[model samples]
Target: MIKKITCNNGLRIISEDISHVRSVAVGIWVQAGSRYELPQENGLTHFIEHMLFKGTATRSAKQIAEEFDRIGGNINAFTSKENTCYYAKVLDHHAKHAVEILADMFFNSLFDPNEIEKERLVVLEEINMVEDTPDDIVHEYLWREMYENNPLGSPILGTEETLNSFTKEMILSYMERHYTPDNVVISVAGNIQEGFLEYIESLFGQYKSVKKPVKSLETPAIKPIYTENFRETEQAHICIAYPGLSINADNIYSLVVLNNILGGSMSSRLFQEIREDKGLAYSIYSYHSSYEDTGVVVVYGGTSSNQLNELKTSIFDSIENVMNKGFTETEILNSKEQLKGNLLLSLESTNARMSRNGKNELLYGKHRTLDEVSETIDEVTLESVVDLAKEIFSHKPAISIIMPKKVDL
Candidate 1:
């Protein structure tokens, strides 16, 4: 069963009880990320994530790690384009202790000046690591072309210039504005014991409620553009982007099914045609990235510099074939089953359940039962998938190519 309790301070507590499991997973989710940042604040949200573990008012970084080790619990955090989460998994008996430690870190982090200086170097090294990776850097270039002039297109890791300029004062000011009670959710899953709700409320309910006003953003129109970055590597990294559905769009299911058949797996058309049949590329795949108001579907692959043009032509041809002739009933059925199996298998994890609960609450403000989702996927018809293909593939893609420095285009 799933339950949600909203405290007097507007902090939400979402949980699920799986009595059979002997462990519990807890997460603190903040509705702040790169999308909530200004151009100058590109990476501050991620930086704050790193700093929270550095130390708190009463515990140094090593002591914090030691505490978790002593309890035989695991703790970590991650930042995305839309949110940040700090989570821990522990034996059910230690649930309260886990919450107490997490609360301490959240409410009393010191953000020491010396620690800030030290972490800056760590983050800078991270930025350099991404630049050194060509396959990773290519996707970053594609977003810049797809969402030109928009913060949505900015890299999650801000530039070296911005990281160097961030001070302790700057970091604190940003946190104060965004880390309000109403802007957070606490999600707990697995082995729900008695008084668990009361225990969480006791630790979190005392915070004063302050709601941050929502900011208005103008949605930038998508413009198709071609761009190429030259590097001294042996292979050419290429990506093509087409505008897709927003997070709430009704046609998202159709697009999901369509992506699977096209290039989502080894049996996908792009994989079978580009690599298996033609022997052109070693790695190829397709994926979608959706935000609150906009989204994009991208197909990416890497190949030798000499075969780059053939690879591009074959990708477009496969897309055009699907658009013109549409996919067969057998193809649609197989893809649907593949997607459903993947979704169902993922639910076997307590961590996956915790993540699903937290995300549904944060993004949609409600939860969908497993049956409800399976039914939605089952409702997708052959005509709907074909229509989605025509709608998506008809557009001329915005292409981003990265080729060897000395290779001719």
Candidate 2:
């Protein structure tokens, strides 16, 4: 069962008590991400994520690492377009110790001047690493084309100019605005110890931010523009994207089912046709990225520059076929069953449960039972999927391609 408690300061805690497991996973979710940043502050949230691990008031960075190592616990954090999470998984006996360490990192990070300069260089190298990889950097170009001038289009790893300009004062100011109690959620899953909830509350509940969390109202309008990057790479990377639904869309299951039939699996149409049948590409897939107010479905393929046209043509043909003919009853059924199976399999992990509960609480503030989700997946019919496909495919897709500089268009 899942339980929730809101602290006096407005921090929300959600947990699932799985008494059978001997491990516990705890995540601290904050609504601080690239999307909330001003144009000048792009990647600030991700930078802050790195800074939190450098050192805290009472623990050196190495000490924090050693403490987790001592308990045989796993500790890490990630920054996304929508939020940031710092999580730890440990044996249930070490749960309190893990939480204390996380709280220390969260509330007491020094963000020392020397550390900031060193980490800035580290992040610059990270950015350069991505720039050197064509396949990875192509998606960043796609977002720039799709969202145009919106902050949503900006990369989570800010550019060198912005990174160099970020001062300690700036970091603190951004946190003061977005890292409020109301914008944070603590999610715990697995064999929760007695008084664990109170323990967490005692650690996280007292602190409160005076500033209200600010969200950007600038909704990104899709620009179905074709953009290309010329790189001296062996293969041409391409991404075809269509506008999709929001996280809370009612027909989200239908879209998921449709994506599966298109390119989600090895048996999927894009994989079977593009890779297996024609040998056009080795890596080809489709996925949906849904946000709060809107989403996008992207089909990605990488092929030799000489075969780039064929790859692009084949992908379009597959999408056109699906839109024109729709999916068979068997395809819809199998996709739904596959999704249900994946969902069931993921529940065995405390980490997965912690993440799911954390994201759902952070985004929707509601939880659906396993049966409820399975039922929703089961309810996705062929007609619903086909209709959604038609609607999604009707739009002019935004296209992004990265090709060898010598390959002439």
Q: TM-score of predicted model 2?
A: 0.99
* Model 1, runs deviating above 4 Å: 209-213, 406-409
lDDT of 2 by residue, 1-409 (tens): 9999999999999999999999999999998889889989998999999999999989999999999999999999999989999999999999999999999999999999999999999999999999999888999999988998887899999899999999899989999999999999999999999999999999999998869888875778789999988887889999999999999999999999999999999899999999999999999999999999989999999999999989999999999999999989999999999999989998889999999999999999999999999999999899999999999999999999999854554
Superposition TM-score, candidate 1 onto the true structure: 0.97
Give a tens-digit lDDT track for model 1, residues 280-360.
999999998777788888999999989898899899999899899999998889998989999999988678888889988
Clashing pairs in 1: none
Instruction: Report the number of the highest-TM-score candidate.
Output: 2
Which has the greatest lDDT?
A: 2
Q: Which pairs, if any, clash in model 2?
A: none
List the global CA lDDT of all models.
Answer: 0.87, 0.94
TM-score of each: 0.97, 0.99
lDDT of 2: 0.94
